[model samples]
Target: MPRIVSAFLCAAFIALGVTACAEPAHQKHAPQDPPDYKGVPTDMTPPSMLTPSAKPQ
Candidate 1:
């Protein structure tokens, strides 16, 4: 009976050790979009057209 109990304990200890030493499962994360930023004007216009040209000196 003691031999059987010791053998069972040894087997349990080995199983627990193997599981504890194993690597954890990989976790995946969803890609996140950056914050919506409004910087430049939406309309594409040339600076020269927006402002009148200075008279040549």
Candidate 2:
């Protein structure tokens, strides 16, 4: 039983090592400036497009 447990642990560790080594290297994305929002519109919908919801009696 002890040997079986040890074998399973060793297999699991080897599997983990193999998977770790198979992954792609970490990539560094180029730094980018955030988009300017100084002139953007804040209101998505105007008051003219609003409608009252019908209520059940």
Candidate 3:
């Protein structure tokens, strides 16, 4: 009967779904070591003070 076929198909789909959800989840691996941070130094001198005419004669 059509009802029997429908019930079998539904059961098959439910089993497939359960099997798919039962698999272990993937995990990300951690890095071996952290990278070193080098700090950047800023220039404190004024732009106008670096010009040739701005220097002492």
Best by the TM-score measure: 1
* lDDT (Cα) of model 2: 0.85
Against the correct fold, how does model 3 do in TM-score? 0.41
Q: Write the per-residue lDDT of candidate 2 for residues 6-53, one digit (tens) a residue.
A: 999999999999998896677579766568746767778977788867
lDDT of 1 by residue, 1-57 (tens): 999999999999999999999987875876665678547468788776797867998
Predictions in order: lDDT: 0.85, 0.85, 0.79
Candidate 3, overall lDDT? 0.79
Worst 10 residues of 1 by lDDT: 31-40
**Tens digits of per-residue lDDT for model 3 on 1-57?**
999999999999999999898966765785454466455457878877786665575
Error of 2 at 56 (Å): 95
Give the Cα error of residue 9 in candidate 2, in Å: 0.1
